[model samples]
Target: MNAHDARGSTQLLTRLFDATPSDAELQEALKAAREEYRVLRWWKLGQPAVDAIKVKLDIPQERAGSVLTELVQLHSDKLQVTVNAFPYGLPALDGVLVDVTMERQVTG
Candidate 1:
C-alpha cells in the first residue's frame, strides 16, 4: 500500500548517549551515570513531537527535527541516532503470520 494508506504506521528515530568510560569499567565509574536516550517519530504532524524532545533536552532551536533532510545536520557528539520506518497495511501483511502466546508466567 501507499504511504497514505498506511494509517497506523510511523517512522521512529532514536538517539543514544553513553558515558565516556569503557563498558567493562562502567560499573566502577561512579561519576559517569548514563543519560537517557531520546526517540523521535515522524508523521504528518510530527514536528511537535520533535520539538518536545528539543525542549526537554534543551537542544538548540536550530536543531529542530521538523524535516528528515535536516535531521542529520542537527546531530552532535552528544548522541547517536538511528532511524526506522514501519509502514503496515495490506501490503505489509500480504503473507505474514500472526502468533499469540496463551501461556502466562507465575512469579513469586
Candidate 2:
C-alpha cells in the first residue's frame, strides 16, 4: 500500500485497542509481534518485514522511536529504515494515543 493507505490502516487498527496505551505497553506488544512474525517466516534479522511487521504490530510513539533507533544502529549494515508514529487523542498522561511503524527497505 501507499504511504497514505498504510497510515490509514494503522490508525484504524490502533483504534481497536484501548483509546490510549502507554509507550512501554505498545513497545512490548510490537516487540512480541515482530518476534512471532520472524520466527514464523524464518527470515533473516534485517529484512523489510522486521520493521514493517513492527509497525503492523502497533507500538507507541516514544518507545517505538527508541526501539527503531536501536535496531537501526544494531543492524546498520543489513537494513535501511524509516519509522513513523501517528499520535491520537489528547496529550495527557492517561489518554495519550500513538501508532508506530518502522519500515525497512528491501533491496535485491
lDDT tens string, model 1, 1-108? 443332222211221222233555546543332222122322222342321132112122232233233344444554333332232246333221111111112234
- TM-score of structure candidate 2: 0.30
TM-scores vs. true structure, each candidate? 0.19, 0.30
The RMSD of every model to the true structure, in order and in angstroms, is 20.6, 14.7
The top-ranked prediction according to lDDT is 2
lDDT string, candidate 2, 12-50, tens digits: 333333234567887898787565332222222333222
Give the C-alpha miss distance for residue 41 in model 1, angstroms. Answer: 7.1
**Model 1 RMSD, rounded to 1 decimal:** 20.6
Q: Model 1: which residue pairs collide?
A: none
The numbered model that scores best in TM-score is 2
